[model samples]
Target chain A: MENDDTEYPVRYIPASKVLQAKVPFLDVSPNIALKKANNVLEEMAKDYVNWVQEDIKRLESTYQDLCEDPKSKDAITALYRVSYAMKGQGGTFGYDLVTFILNNLCRYLEEREEFNEGQLELIELHIESVRMVITHELTGKGGEMGKQVIMGLKQMINKKG
Target chain B: MSAKMLDLSNINILIIDENANMRIIVKQILRALDAHTTKEASGGAEAFTTLKTFNADIILTTWMMSPINGVEFTKMLRTSSDSPNPMVPVIMLSGHTEARYISEARDSGVTEFMAIPISPKSLYLRIAEVVLRPRQFVQTNDFFGPDRHRHDNEKYRGELRRQEDKEKQQDEMELTDAHNSLLKPD
Candidate 1:
């Protein structure tokens, strides 16, 4: 392909000095800074439990909305949005099982413009599993129960495929 | 994990996300970093409104959002006359790890990309990159954002290639050779 760079005149503006002036370069040790930051994250994790509870409720309601009217894009989007939000937060607080379950659901939703009966069922099952995870304070992989839940979800997805 | 310590005490950041939980988590982390100020917005449109007075040195936005997504918001910020600062660095936070999604975000003028469940260390490193080693902004007929070429491609001859950049690279290489020779007398 022939390159025509003349169409747009390019100019480069060096931006480092300007940004450096605003963002201070500290002498503080990284280990100490990270420790403080992690402490803050840990403090925030306390809220995550309650937050995920509300999120599960939101997921359950979204599922209900989809069930009542499977053709509604709004419900589907809401379902997807909630799942995606949960996936991003769960890992920070040791709720990796929630993230693992929802990651699959998010992918499924991403590929779908519309839902089918089995699709809705799959989504419902995911929502239920996450609800279980949250309700039981099931963090990390959720141990044996988590493994079983993940395996079951995978089997359902494979069956659909 | 990085060695550099940042004094975030003077930096003001704007965070835009549709998820409340995300906003809470990010704001908490930013505060923990001692960011001088942070203004939160639920989505891109609200972020635009907040930008009118926020004086944000950096923007952290989620890739997917309602009302206006991060890509659209970035394009407008880079081009819009009303944008408070056209050249402000934007670090896009995302859950979507698809290649296409990342490419779209980059093309739309995001300065950096981070897949979320953001840890303090990862977030700080990104902040440090933008501040300590900022890329030059490039303006043209179509795009007005950071220079997309993060490193020089010496093999390809292009109309826009700078001779100065080639010379700079050669000088650095020679300097490295000299330093290596000094370190090893053999």
Candidate 2:
């Protein structure tokens, strides 16, 4: 390798050994660690059914606030943050539809401003769809209805965008 | 190494997110992995305070936060003179997996980006990568943090650039030439 030592503003620090010394690789099977972790998530999923309702309520209230003041950039951004949480949690709890819906919503909200009537309505439709999924315990793919809801949302996103 | 298990219990890890529930979820997952020492903070400010004494080896943070967000927190960790464990690996957690969001986190010095709705497998993989394959840290006039490049002749790790960086890099080449002269066969 050429020593391109330009008197550059860059300074390179060697990789830190502070953590490595403590987290050394051991002979234990990776499967054991993975199994333990999966167990934890499986346990959490049980309560996720109840916890997700609060998230939906927060999502609804944020949407309502955005509806009241469509011009408020903060309101729109806050709404997105609420959706962000749901997007992360939904899949872990078997609410893949919620994850899918909120994931799409976050993309729409990213750097988005000026929510026209159609856009707002579309947003509302998404929230309601998510609510329906959770309320019905539509876990895996939500079967046929899940397909329809996801397809409908995609179409609306195209039109709204 | 492939057959070996990762030991997370020996090292301290920090969880920083505004959402309490997310913190719990991450903590539980870490616990399952046998992580014995872990700390939690509500947001960036709390994270800084926690850093004062915790000496965390890894930091898992959320993207969107009130007051000071993940990006802001990362910049501080990389640049702040008083920052505790400034070289600690930062893994950003965000449900928004958009390129822009991930790029933004990377630009600000995140060591790893984990798009959320996270699974135990994905989470474990991320932790394993950061632990097993730590990246070199790079500091420049404009940015300071983990070298962004995974490979390639130590390329400039920062995306944010200035006219001066170009000029400064030119100066670096001149210095490199001078240093190379010592290696020449006379």
Candidate 3:
């Protein structure tokens, strides 16, 4: 049995000492570990991108329904909750890119900010850009699409501010 | 009830996450668990300030943060006993599945490690585990109560909003060379 007296964040204990030792947080700076840990995070980000894409579709559909009837307080509350969940999980998963994009999306929802068509389009494009980034991170092929989307978002935010 | 879990109403829990939505989600989870009051921080520096001032009974912090990540922050906290602030129990949260992450967190004086997507049930269970078995989890601190905690969630939330807006504006305006560097090597 391993010693139970071991303190965390200092002594590393794992089944395979070799694989465990390479757990980058213990040895390397976060910048370097980002690369070492990228493989699993890339896979996780791919899965999460699919999840977020589905969520965005659902959110957009709900928003459209609410715009038609504007009285679905329960639906609105639930939408906020889902946005909050995405924000939490996105940050936790080491997908700060996803987190950044979702945070912007959530801010619009939280503030109940009425989005003009152009602003709504910008938000959608940002979400799509985040999705493209996740895809690129996963498959290393969608880099240009991701960059273009990010560039567009930059232009929009800059123009608005 | 089985073994009588720790009464959260009496315990001052500090939740630290760099994300505002995360702070809200974790607060909602605790609130669902009948926890009436939770001290929250958006980042490690803010968390430290809150801990020094409010003095929580237990701390729940996310592992990754800008400026000071959870592991480094906890290490700094464990050393704060010699400073003005005394020791406090810390629970570190992580999304990674690797056990070594937990080990590192533990070694750095983290009281417990709870995997992320921090739902009410998982957070309550983790808190119960730590509060129940202090010797195995964290060193007991007799100086924690709800009354001692400051009700500054609103203030912290406002400050966080300002910071987030500033960061977003900067990201938009500068499109700094550092942005691409943060993503991956070109």
Candidate 4:
């Protein structure tokens, strides 16, 4: 159980390195290419951060309501859609971490009919993992948030205690 | 699960393009066809990440984009083995009229293509064709998952028949062994 408050799970992939490895814009002017590339990187980070913010707000207001109700299928469906939305965009923009987290989120939500309290807790942990990545990446939080999220999820998912 | 137009209410479509006006126009077309859910991605990377996270039923992207072009994005997606709904039809919309470019798009796993300035009627019909086309090939794990969910009820029936054949063979072997013992006639 290494869920220390000091350690976060967010990992950073440098934008320059990502551009070199993943996308190389050819036939476009250098300034235009860099501008386009940077805009994409910035927008993806911004959009993801905003999406998590909305999710957090929704959870705060409706968490108990959804958890207690059996007919909250719409709420569950919305959550799955959010994760699936991330799945489509994350890998293309070089945010593999977000892509991976959302994918796990999708799998968890897909099995919602069979989800137990423990599995629900893991979903929360996965959300935390996403928040951790977004907070650090967006604010340049000097890496604290990432460690907290990473360690929290590791504690939840790691069974070899 | 009904094949009728009203039954697909749960489907969310992702439309990728750099043009805001184009996104809105396409959304309107989809909505006209009873598609209520739509998400927009403005660039290849954003579109890529969105596709990775979203459980969208269809993806309509333009070939010309800044940063990561549509061709490159499509190529990258085709390489991923863990992509959910790998068989999800991707229809590329391009303004390019060159035959060379069209074939290139086809070669890159683009299920269908349409010229830009696409009319509402054409868009609707193209979408219907893509969604309703008969499944002829093995949508194996060559895509992300088994083509079990997206396949029509008829395909599932065929799979069930294969399973039944295996079960019947097992039963016949047991019966044959019993008959052989009886024939020994001790």
DockQ of each: 0.41, 0.40, 0.04, 0.01
Model 4, B45-159: lDDT tens digits are 7876787678766678887666776766665655556555455567787655356666676556565667654544345445544544412222222332112122346575466
Ranking by TM-score: 1, 2, 3, 4
RMSD to native, candidate 4? 24.0
Give the TM-scores of the predictions, in the order they appear.
Answer: 0.85, 0.84, 0.43, 0.38
Query: Which candidate should be chosen as best, given DockQ against the real structure?
Result: 1
Lowest lDDT 10-residue stretch of candidate 4 chain B: B170-179
Write model 2 residue lDDT over B8-91, tens digit each, in one string.
Answer: 878888999888788888888888888879999988888999999998888999888888999999989888888887888999
CA lDDT, candidate 3, residue A68:
52
Evaluation by DockQ, superior candidate among 1 and 2: 1
The C-alpha lDDT values of all candidates are 0.78, 0.79, 0.55, 0.54
Greater-DockQ candidate between 2 and 3:
2
Per-model root-mean-square deviation over C-alphas: 7.6, 9.9, 17.7, 24.0
lDDT score for residue A150 of model 2: 87
Tens digits of per-residue lDDT for model 3 on B1-186? 112223355556788887665666566566545455689888878877786677576788887676788888877776655433434567777653255665577667776677665544456556654443332223323211111112235586456557778666321112212222332332
Q: Pick the candidate with the highest lDDT.
A: 2
Which stretches of model 3 miss by more than 4 angstroms?
A: A1-161, B1-6, B81-86, B136-186
Q: What's model 3's lDDT at B98? A: 59
RMSD of 1: 7.6
Report the C-alpha lDDT of model 2 over A34-111, residue by residue, as the tens digit: 678788888888888788889888888999999999989889888988888788888876788988888888877875
TM-score for the second chain in candidate 3? 0.67
Clashes per candidate, residues 3 or more apart or on different chains: 0, 4, 13, 32
The CAPRI category of model 1 is acceptable
lDDT of 2 at A119: 89
- Per-residue C-alpha lDDT of model 4 across residues A1-161, encoded as one tens digit per residue: 12223334322211112112222222322233224434544554456556556655544344444456534776676566455544434444445566666666666666565445676667767766666665656233225655566566777866421
